[model samples]
Target: MSGEMIYPRGSGAYFEQLRALLPRGAAWICEAGTTLGKLLSGLAVELARIDARGIDLIEEADPRTAYELLPDWERVAGLPDTCTGAPETARERQAALHQKLTSTGGQTIAYFIDLAAKAGFLIEIDEHRPAVVGMACDAELYGEAWAFAWTVRVLPFNGTQQGELPVAVAEAGDPVGIPLRGWGALDLECLIGRARPAHTTVLFAYEVEPEPALWFDFTR
Candidate 1:
């Protein structure tokens, strides 16, 4: 008798949850540090199939080129100008400003970094000590659905040797939950769940690949 092919455990479950969370016809934005950024790359491949294209957040030489790399830039540029007024809450005001910035192109990296900081979606994470890293996904891509943002602290450890990076989600500006680990297919699912969207435009302070993965054959 031939043995059945064994794939990574929980990978199927992860994909199922991903499919449920991101249905057909839904749009999504993905950002990653670089080609070797870790779990984001794998997730982007599957997610992109359902129209959740990835954007490269890696810093480039030219600002205009970076601006041009954003997905749906033309549409964002076409949005009506945002109004200047007192919003009911701080979050509202932040959202308003974010809309204005994204709607108009030709933004510099400093602008994005500042915006990400105000929105609590930018931080230092790869340092030697435990530090928070903020991540976000835009709701504009999905036409006004809630945008997701989360702050996670990367635990101090040798990820290269262990083959995993331990992380803990932050709550009320404090770390919570048992530290989750790994950067596998299943690990990406957990990270996504923790960073569930909740705002208008997804405000991320980094860059991601603008192109879809053209080589991986997920199905085997």
Candidate 2:
């Protein structure tokens, strides 16, 4: 991968295409270089009007610290640190760590979703293979029912050979016609010019108001 930054082209067109596929409500798309944990934390803050509290099992060294600091927020256990055994090649180590993190991350997210649901938020899981995770509100909060959908893709960086690196591609697909969740697939193609593995996070958010004024309105 190259050392310089590489911004993707046709981002607007790509977003427009996704918007067309959104369920009968207004929708918005945003891309970032963060993780699911961070995204959910932000959502919790928005919904609760206070600091979003969750176990930082992904990046934090001391999960207890978060619990101590945010005593009022809901807390859960973090993922256990896994050891990557010695491997003959770099690829093996990379694969091992990737699998470990992905598995743990999914479990943590699942736990968070359940906690949110129990707290009165409606949850929606994308039915497509490897299902994307989503959440929405049943009752109108702040004048509308808010919904959020997100998906993560891990892209491993393959060292450049002969002065060229591979480009990541997310194939375009037909709109998933599910009614309750509303189907809009996120397709992201990114070029990582650096020689390091990275994760791309895609988030969609919209608000549906009550009857008469009920409609999906994209926010952020």
lDDT of 2 by residue, 1-220 (tens): 5332233342334334443554563233223433532343344344443222332433233322333322222122222222222445434434433433344323334553443333223333231122223535442232111123233322222233222222333345644552344222211111111111233233333222212436676994
lDDT of 1: 0.35
Q: Which ten residues in a row have the lowest lDDT in candidate 2?
A: 187-196
Work out the TM-score per prediction: 0.17, 0.16
Model 1 residue runs over 4 Å out of place are: 1-98, 101-103, 121-220
lDDT of 1 by residue, 79-198 (tens): 222213344653454444456555443233444334334433333221121223442342123321222233233222232333333333434644555334332223323322323333
Model 2 alpha-carbon miss at residue 73, Å:
14
How many Å off is the CA of 112 in candidate 1? 2.3
Clashing pairs in 2: 1-193, 2-193, 26-216
Q: By summed lDDT, which 10 consecutive residues of candidate 1 come out lowest?
A: 200-209
